[model samples]
Target: MSAVPLEAVVIGASAGAMEALSALLPALPQNFRLPVFVVVHLPPDRKSLFAEIFQAKCRVPVREAEDKEPIRAGTVYFAPPNYHLLIETGRSIALSSDEPVLYSRPAIDVLFESAADAYGPALAGIILSGANEDGARGLKAVAAAGGVTMIQRPDEAQAPDMPLAALAACPQAHILPVAGIAAFLQAL
Candidate 1:
C-alpha cells in the first residue's frame, strides 16, 4: 500500500472488463472519498452503457465522462465510446478524439498517463482483465510519477495478456486477485 494518501483512482480494462468491473466497482461504499476514472475498450461505433449499468449496482455515483467536467469525489466516471478520457492538470475531465492507441480509441494508456500527470503520488492506478498490452506503459508512467500501481493476478484474470504485460513493464506493481483489489479500494 502507498504511504501517500490517495486522491483518485484510475482503472483500465478490456476484453473481460464488464465482469472484472462488476466485481470491483460495486464494492465502493457510497461515501468513498476518491474520484474513480475508468477506461474500458469499447467499440467506436456504439454508445457506452457502462454508466447506466454500473450506476444500478454501485453505491457511488456512476456516469459517462463528459468533456471539461469537474472531477468529483465518490463518483465513477467511465469514458464514452470512441473518446480518450484525460484528467487535466486542474483536476478536471477532458475528452479527446485523438487517433486510437493500440487499436482502441478510449485507450487505457491515455487515461492512466494523463491521470498520473494530474494526480502524481496522490493517484492509484489499477490494471484489470484485458487481451491486449495497452495499459503497460501507462502503469509504468503512474509508477514513475510515484502513484500506487496494481494489476490483477494474471492467473485469476479472464483475459491475462493485459495484466501480464503490465507486470512485465512494472515489476513492482502490487499483484492481487479481483476481490483483493476491491477490498483495497474499499479501505482507501
Candidate 2:
C-alpha cells in the first residue's frame, strides 16, 4: 500500500447525487489511475440502473458490487440497491442488510469508515450533493484518519444540506465547486 502513492479514493453523494456524479465521472479521463469507491443513497427495494448509466459515460468500467468481489482499479462499483457495501483486504467487498443509517441503507458513513481504515492517509474522500447528514461523520472519520477530504461547495450543490453539514463537521474539508472538484481529481 505504501508503494501505491494513493491507495484508493472514496466518494459519497445523495439527494441530487445523480446529477453531481454524472458530471464528475465523465471528467475523469480514460486510464485514470486510482480505484474509486462510492456510496450513493438510493431507495431500497428498487433496483437501480445507475451502474449501467455511469458505465456508458465513464471511461472507467462500472458494475454493481457482488458480495466478496475484489475491488479493482479503473472500475467503479455501486452498492447493490438494498445493501450496504463494505471494504475488506485487497479489492474484496462485503454486503449487509443491516439497518439503515441516516435513513440510508448504503450509508455514506459505512463506505467512508471502512475505506478510511483500509487506506488511511492514502485515501481521498469526497462528499457531493445530498439532502441529509449521512456523509458528515464519515468524512470526519476519514479526515481524522489522515486522509484528504473534499466537499462540493454548498452554493453549487443542488441540495446544500449535506455539503453544509459536512463542512460544519469537517472544518478542514476543501470546499470546491463541482467543476473545480472535477479538475482537482484530475490533477491528482
Candidate 3:
C-alpha cells in the first residue's frame, strides 16, 4: 500500500521553476507521501542536472525517467531534457525530435494527458510558473479524468502566461499561491 494518501502527483514547471520547486519540495516530509512526476522544459541534447540537484534536497529518491519502469511510491520522476515523459502503467520516457507541441518537447501536456489515462482520479496535476502555454490542456484532461487540478495564481507567477493559460482553459481550476499549493496536495 502507498504511504501517501494520493496515488500520484504530476507537476510541470518552466520559467522560474527552480525557485518554485525549491520552495515546494522541502515542504513534504523526507519520506514524502506519494509518487511524484515532474516535467520541466529543458533544451534537447543538454545533460540535465535537475534530477541530481533535486535528489539532494529531497528525501525521496529521484531520477530521470526510464521507459517501462514500474510506478513506485515516494519517488520523484523527471522527464529527460529531450523526451516527453508519460505514464502508461509503466512510466515511459520517449525521445523524439518531432515538432514541439506548444513549443516544448518534454511538454507538460503530454505527461498530464497520458497520466490522466493511466491513473485517472488517482492523479493530481499542478501547473506552475512557465513561459509557454503548455500545461493547460493537459490539466484539463486531468480534470476530465476525475483527477484533481491546480494552477499557480497567475499574479504570483514569475511568468504568468502559463498559469493564465491554464486558467483560460480550465476556469474551474483551483488558483493558489506557492505556499498554499503544498498544503493543498497534503489535503488530497
Candidate 4:
C-alpha cells in the first residue's frame, strides 16, 4: 500500500505516559519532518514540566504550545496543563479553558478532533497508553477524516484501556507496540 504524506501528527497519553513517551520520542530521527502535537493528562491545579522533560530527552525541539503559534515541522508541541489545545483554520494553535472531556482538561479528544478537522487526510493520530477511554472517539474522528490512525498494542501498553477503547471505536487503526510505532513513523 502507498503511504500518505502527513503534514502533522497528534499523540495522546496518560497514566504511565512518561515511560511510554520516553521510549517513543527518542526514536524519531533528528531530521524527521512533521509537527507533533501531544496531550498528556495532568492535574489542572498543578504546573507541568512535560515539555521540558521531553525536550531534554528528544532529538527535536519540544515546547508548550502557544495560542496563534504557527506549527513548524520537526517541532513537538505539548498542550499546557490546564487548557484544551485546538487548531485554528489558519494552521495556528488556540488554547481553551473549555470544560474538560473524560475528566481531563487537556483532553486528547479535543486535540485530535480539532487537528483532524484542520489537517484532514494529511494528519496522523496516535493513541498511547492511558488509564481512561478518552482518545477513542478522537481516533475515530481521525480515521473518518481520512487521516491515518495508530493505537498502541493493548498487550504492550502499560495501561491498555485507552488503546483498547480506541480499537473498539476504530477497529481499522494500526495496532503496534511502542517500538513498532517508532519504526512505522520513521518509515513515513
Q: Give the number of the best model, judged by TM-score.
A: 1
CA lDDT of 18 in candidate 2? 92
**Every candidate's CA RMSD:** 0.6, 2.1, 3.0, 1.1
TM per candidate = 0.99, 0.95, 0.91, 0.97
lDDT of each: 0.95, 0.86, 0.83, 0.91
Model 2 stretches astray by more than 4 angstroms: 1-4
Provide backbone clash counts, one per model: 0, 2, 0, 0
Candidate 3 residues lying further than 4 Å off, grouped into runs, are 1-5, 90-98
Arranged by TM-score with the best first, the candidates are 1, 4, 2, 3
- For model 3, what is the C-alpha lDDT against the true structure? 0.83
User: Which ten residues in a row are the worst by lDDT in model 4?
Assistant: 1-10
Off by over 4 Å in 1: none
Q: In model 4, state the lDDT of residue 148.
A: 91
Per-residue accuracy of model 2 over 129-154 as CA lDDT, tens digit each: 99999999999988988888899999
> Over the stretch 4-84, how does candidate 4's per-residue lDDT look in tens digits?
688899999998798889888878889989999999999988878989988898899999998889888899999999999
The pairs that clash in candidate 1 are none
Q: Could you say which candidate leads in lDDT?
A: 1
